[model samples]
Target: MAPEPVRETDPTIGRLVTDASRDISSLVRKEIELAKSELKVSAKAGGLGIGLFAAAGFIAVLAIIMLSVAIAYFIHWAGLGLHWSFLIVFGFYLLVAGLLVFLGVRSVKKVKAPEKAIEQGRQIPQALKGKS
Candidate 1:
């Protein structure tokens, strides 16, 4: 296969090509900025997710410890032929679990997206045009 010859007939064609090149370069820069902004957002989201999961795991372990205490109490009370005392311990466990779940939900609700970077990304093109 032979390579095609390059041709430039009019001055307008040259100007147009230059303008097109500038536009493409501007667009690429804008896209890079957008990607960076999005990556920052994703990183923040991922970090929050990891933190929340860690908290949930900690809460789960605490809940297990509470349940163990309840079991021990149940065994002690049942040994004295009192079954109702076990119910009290079980209820305490339920209350603690419910409170933890409520707190977790509130924490999740407080999480907000990092919007400033995204807004800056949006404004870059306009800033570039003003510079030109």
Candidate 2:
């Protein structure tokens, strides 16, 4: 007796399921790879942006120093002694810096720990053990 030939057009249920799972897995992997690549580009751009911002901030600081010098020179032109004019500008900057440090310390002292999240974290092991 001759055996029947397998038809390619009609796939078995098991074969279909296997094909579907393989296709889904491939799709998921491709999506993950795409996301990783996109994230890499985004991270590179973000790093570049941060560097540019830092450069800008440094430039701004230089500009501020120049302005401070200009102000001191203006004060000297207005008949104050050059040394005293520079000294006054230096004193003003020192006072402003001290105030900022004081305020920063006060703000930092107000920071509290995350109490609720900590309590929930403590409950995680008990929950896993099936205890309330």
Candidate 3:
């Protein structure tokens, strides 16, 4: 068997430019996808937080109604301590409302900026400049 002659040639400037352009376009599309995914997660968390807040508000309204009933009972407390029962119920409602509000706040706090995507986006300029 005879050895074949090697035929290697440097890429033309136009070819290099086209390849680079294609790579950059692909990178941009991927970045956009990553951002969309991250935003979806944040949006879901925010929605959950809003729902919890609404529930807490409704419970607070119920607590107010209970308080009104307790007041009415107190007005008729002539040697009768029935107002105490209503007062206890109102307190329990308030406690539950407070718990819901706390959970809502925690969920809202969990909704954060897409740090990974942002960091990757920032690196794009450096990457274009041939820097790591």
Candidate 4:
């Protein structure tokens, strides 16, 4: 890019400094906005995933409950004691709940925040400070 010719009437360095300041301000603002937008998109996606997973877990629990009741009744029909049949169903549900909890924790731990924009933002201040 060619520098504009400095006129004899007005000072050029002052104009250059002002333009640089404005441009840097605009750049930092835009960078901050970009970081914010990226974070928002990431949060929405993660939230949706977590919400869907929770819904799936809820449905699973409901299904397990229904199936347990059906099985307990079927076992009762085969001459097993009623309370013992229900206890067996309860034990099965506990096992399923434990598995769900373990899987949920692992899934959440794997979900990480957006990193690139955050890194760029972190560098902006450092760059402005003349640090590498």
The stretch of ten residues in a row with the least summed lDDT in candidate 3 is 72-81
Best-fitting candidate, scored by TM-score: 2
Q: Per-prediction TM-score, please? A: 0.50, 0.71, 0.52, 0.55
Q: Would you list the C-alpha lDDT of every candidate in the order shown? A: 0.85, 0.99, 0.87, 0.93
Query: What is the total number of backbone clashes in candidate 3?
Result: 0
For model 1, how does the per-residue alpha-carbon lDDT over 47-130 read when each residue is reduced to its tens digit? 999999999999999998787777767677667434556666678779999999999999999998879989988889989899
User: What lDDT would candidate 1 get against the real structure?
Assistant: 0.85
Quote the RMSD, in angstroms, for model 2: 6.1
Worst 10 residues of 2 by lDDT: 3-12
lDDT of 3 by residue, 14-129 (tens): 98999999999999999999999999999999999999999999999999887778675765574446766566667877899999999999999999999999999999999999
Which segments of model 3 are wrong by more than 4 Å? 1-7, 78-132
Best by lDDT: 2
Tell me the tens digit of each residue's lDDT in model 4 across 3-118: 98867987588888999999999999999999999999999999999999999999999997798899999988899999999998888879989999999999999998889989
> Please, what are the lDDT tens digits per residue for candidate 2 over residues 7-119?
98889999999999999999999999999999999999999999999999999999999999999999999999999999999999999999999999999999999999999
Q: Rank the candidates by TM-score, best first.
A: 2, 4, 3, 1
TM-score of candidate 3 to 2 decimals: 0.52
